[model samples]
Target: MIIRELITHRWGNKELVTSPSFGTVEKVFVKDDMRVLEWEPLFIIRTENGSLEQIAVGVNGVINSVHVKEGDHVIPGMVMAFIKDDLLDSDIS
Candidate 1:
């Protein structure tokens, strides 16, 4: 699958959030145990082209862990964070 399409994965009550593009993480807006809503901006990345892109968990959840920090270089499909998602298995297609 393409990187952007792999950005989120449903694993029981948890979700994995992955990077969609190659870039440096510019900022992280949440920390472990923080609750977030679907489509909420969780991180901002500065791409190689110097443009910024926002990354989100893509599901409602409490952050379980974060794997990237500001200034870390990320490529497509890199795991950026894990979330304790509220979504059911059927909630994801």
Candidate 2:
């Protein structure tokens, strides 16, 4: 199944933009050339209200897209990054 889809708005025409997970961005753990497992902690976003939230990988895949950098503010529904799931069946030869 293709899991990579551009995040859009409810109107279908507007592009969905992501902001700090909570209210403020604190740190980013994953970077280029890093291998991560499913449900791994990727980053942390601190909210303006003084709450820290941990962002993790939802699936088993490689980090493909990262829209925000350290100290960048983000919101909900934002496309943090794209993960390409590894195919075990295809690898079997």
RMSD of each candidate?
Answer: 4.9, 8.3
* TM-scores of all candidate predictions against the true structure: 0.81, 0.66
Off by over 4 Å in 1: 1-7, 88-93
Candidate 1 similarity to native, TM-score: 0.81
Off by over 4 Å in 2: 1-20, 87-93
The sequence of per-residue lDDT tens digits that candidate 1 reaches over residues 1-93 is: 111223487656678888888989998998999988987888888888888887765588789999999999999889899988675525567
Please write out the lDDT profile of model 2 over residues 1-93, one tens digit for every residue. Answer: 112223323222222224434455577777654666765777677776777777654455455556778887776666666555554314677
Q: lDDT, candidate 2, residue 81?
A: 60
What C-alpha lDDT, on a 0 to 100 scale, does residue 79 get in candidate 2?
Answer: 65
Residue pairs whose backbone atoms clash in candidate 2: 18-75, 18-78, 19-74, 19-75, 20-74, 20-75, 23-47, 24-46, 65-81, 65-82
Q: Would you list the C-alpha lDDT of every candidate in the order shown? A: 0.80, 0.56
